[model samples]
Target: MRGPSAWSVADRELMAAFVSKVNGSAFCIGAHSATAERAYQDGAKVRAVLTDLDSAPVAEGLRATLRMLGTLTGAGTVSADDMREVLSAGVTRDQIGDALAVCAAFDTTNRLADAFGFESPGPGGFEAGADHLLKRGYR
Candidate 1:
């Protein structure tokens, strides 16, 4: 999930998990959640965000981006007005673009995971995968 963008690895991972959650992709949710926890060094925050974004302790920009992505993933389209809301939350268009790229990638991955009936390997495997991702990234 590493890339040249303002969004940190933690944010990208969390967004991936969130998108997977929205798509009901259990494997990607657990996998990306583990990576996000490792990146943030705090698993509770990821749980909080998944449980409820409004109460989660994250930046408004990130929250706004997540909300926008939720709508996009759920609906398969993002209206210009919804994008305006994200931009109004002090999230620059470039940052939204970055977040959108992450969301788009995960959306496809989540779909493939569901279509193929992927399953979570287990908590330990998730952690190990997270370690690998944090160290090696997507390159």
Candidate 2:
């Protein structure tokens, strides 16, 4: 959400997908993965991240930031040293905040989805929307 306005839309979706996957929200992960694929002309990147965060081919800075978010979500605390590591990797304060926001948002959403037993979309459900957007030159 921070960073240059020209930051890749696909990357944002990838971030969302990554957060969803980390939170174990199948629906969001699938939906955002499809969204990112539609925006990037390749869904594999999203799939890869969903399957394995550390292996996802994102910028190193983003990887470090996401890793921090993961630790925060899992441990409920982000130390000053963690902040320094991400900053040293070139992540801006705004970017770090946005990453935290995304993580927090997804955590809430995941709990809601789980509590309500929200059903996941069927396979390929995201493709239709993604394909339509692609045709409209969203990518």
- Local accuracy of candidate 2 as per-residue lDDT tens digits, 2-103: 245334667666776777777788777766678788888776766776677778877778788878877887777889999999999998887777777767
List TM-scores for all candidates, in order. 0.96, 0.79
Model 1 per-residue lDDT at 78:
92
Q: Which regions of candidate 2 are displaced past 4 Å?
A: 1-7, 129-139
Best by lDDT: 1
Error of 2 at 133 (Å): 9.2
Q: List the residue pairs that clash in candidate 2.
A: none
Q: What shift in Å separates residue 71 of candidate 1 from its native position after superposition?
A: 0.2
Taking the tens digit of each residue's C-alpha lDDT, what string does model 1 give over 23-87?
Answer: 98999999999999999999999999999999999998899899999999999899999998888
Please state the error at residue 122 of candidate 1 in Å.
0.8
Compared with the true structure, all predictions reach lDDT values of 0.92, 0.73
